[model samples]
Target: MNDEQLMRYSRQIMLSELDYDGQVRLTESHALIIGLGGLGSPAALYLAAAGVGTLTLADDDRVDLSNLQRQIAHGEADIDHYKAQSAAESIGAINHHCRTQVITERLQGEALQHAVEHADVVLDCTDRFESRDAINRACVAAGTPLVSGAAIRFSGQLAVFDVRDSAAPCYACLYGDSGDEDQLTCAESGVIAPLVGMIGSYQALEALKLLSGCGTSQKGLSTFDGLSGQWRHFGLGRDPHCPVCQWRR
Candidate 1:
């Protein structure tokens, strides 16, 4: 780390868990964030600020007026811009040293697989179930760790799936291959402004932990009800019939 880097991340380096070595690990890591909306916004921002060496942001949609309500990484000026591009600009503003890459299309098939294979950690901040499934499959195949988060209405969910750990349960183990038609989106049901921030920040926290090896790997589902200000956690186990992770055993 140069003199400027030491000064920039001095606060984080002071921590016992993330002392110089962990901060170095973080600076050597690459994270792939597949979404630039509600959850992806804050996750990317924090990761960039924390000095993740590289970040690849992917999203197919353009920013709209409504996104300003919860997507903190974009501003009014970003309206009509591709979300991946807008987010890259925000990350660059926060940490000039953090390398940023943008994917303006919905990533799938070989493209998504290759992205996951290169990343040290993957964040599934996407809203759609199909995208989440594709990300999970790719991460499992690549033996990478995944940090998944979702928020809609007043409810939010977070989980960490480490394909490197045989005992870890994957996203498919919990939701299976079911279509997400029954799931409600912020566009349909509406979301409280701060709810996305809370969950997205947690996603960043999990990703940092996984990258720096400074904290325990969270191995379950954590759900939050913003309306009631309550949180619940449930341990997850591998599904014997899960097509995505069954072969890992």
Candidate 2:
């Protein structure tokens, strides 16, 4: 690390668990965040501000006025702009030192698979199950760690599925192909602004832990009910018969 880098990340380096080596690991890591709406906004901001070396942000939608309430990565002026491009600009302004790449097109099929193959860690801040499943499949195939989060109508859930650990479960283990489409989108239900922030921040934290080799990640379902102000967590185990992980085993 250069003198400026040392000074820039001195706070993280101060932690005994994240000394120079750990900080360096973070600086050398790359993260791919799919989706740029509510969850992606804070996740990308925190990661960039923390000096994550490179971030690849993907989203196909344009920024809309409705997004202003929660998508902090965009502004009023960004209305009608591609969200991925807008978010890249937002992150660049926050930390010019961090490399940011924008994928303005939807991540699907081979394109999605290719992105995950190159990332050290992938964040599924996306809003739909189809995208979530695609991301999860790629992560599992690549043996990469994934931190997934979701928020809608005062309810939020976060989980880490690490294919790097043979014993850890993939997302498919928790929600099979039968997962209801109605339950996957934020459009059908409204989300509280701070709920997305809280969950997205946790996603960034988990990504950092996995990247820096620091602490244990939220490697299971961590659910929060903001309306009732209740938080609950549950452990997840790999399905011995899980089709994906089982093949590797």
Candidate 3:
């Protein structure tokens, strides 16, 4: 770390868990974030600001005027722009030292697998169940840790699936392969803006912990109800019949 880096991250480095060595680990790690919308926005910002060495942002959607309500990574000027590119610009503004790669398309198949393999940690910030399932499969295949989050209406969910751990459950184990075509989205059912920020920030926290090996993984599922202002956490069990991860057992 140079003099500038030392000063820039001095606060985090001061911690016992994230001393110089941990900070170095974070600086040498790569994070893959799929989605540059509500959940991906805060996750990418925090990861970049925290000095993740490399960030790969993948999102096929363009920034809509409605996104500025919760997608903190983009602004009015970025409306109509590709979300991946807009997010990269925001990240660059916060941390010039953090290298960013933008993939302005939805990733799947070999491309998704390659991205998962390269990343030290993957953040599944996408909204669709299909994308989440694909990401989970790729992470499980590559034995990479995944931080998944979702927000809709007044509720949000978060989970960490460390496929490197034999006991951990993959996303498929929790939600299964069945597609919920009628699932409510932020667009369909109005969302509270801060709900996404809360979940996305937690995703970033989990990624940092996984990357630096500084904290215990928050295994299982965590759900938040904005209306009730309460959080519920439950242990997750691997399903024996899970198609995506059954072979692991």
lDDT of 3 at 156: 95
Q: Write the per-residue lDDT of candidate 2 for residues 47-92, one digit (tens) a residue.
A: 9988899999999999999999999999999999999899899888
Looking at model 1, the pairs that clash are none
User: What's the true lDDT of residue 70 in model 2?
Assistant: 91
lDDT of 1 by residue, 1-249 (tens): 999999999999999999999999999999999999999999999999998999999999999999999999999999999999999999988999899989998899999999999999999998888888989999999999999999988999999999798888889999998856787788989999999999999999999999999989787999999989999999888998997889886
**Residue-pair clashes per candidate:** 0, 0, 0
In candidate 2, how many Å is residue 162 off?
0.5
lDDT of 3 by residue, 119-142 (tens): 999999988888888999999999
Task: Give the candidate number with the greatest lDDT.
Answer: 3
RMSD to native, candidate 3: 0.8
> For model 1, what is the alpha-carbon lDDT of residue 202?
98
Q: Which whole-number lDDT from 0 to 100 does residue 114 have in model 3? A: 99
Q: Which stretches of candidate 1 lie over 4 Å from their true place?
A: none
Backbone clash pairs for candidate 3 read none
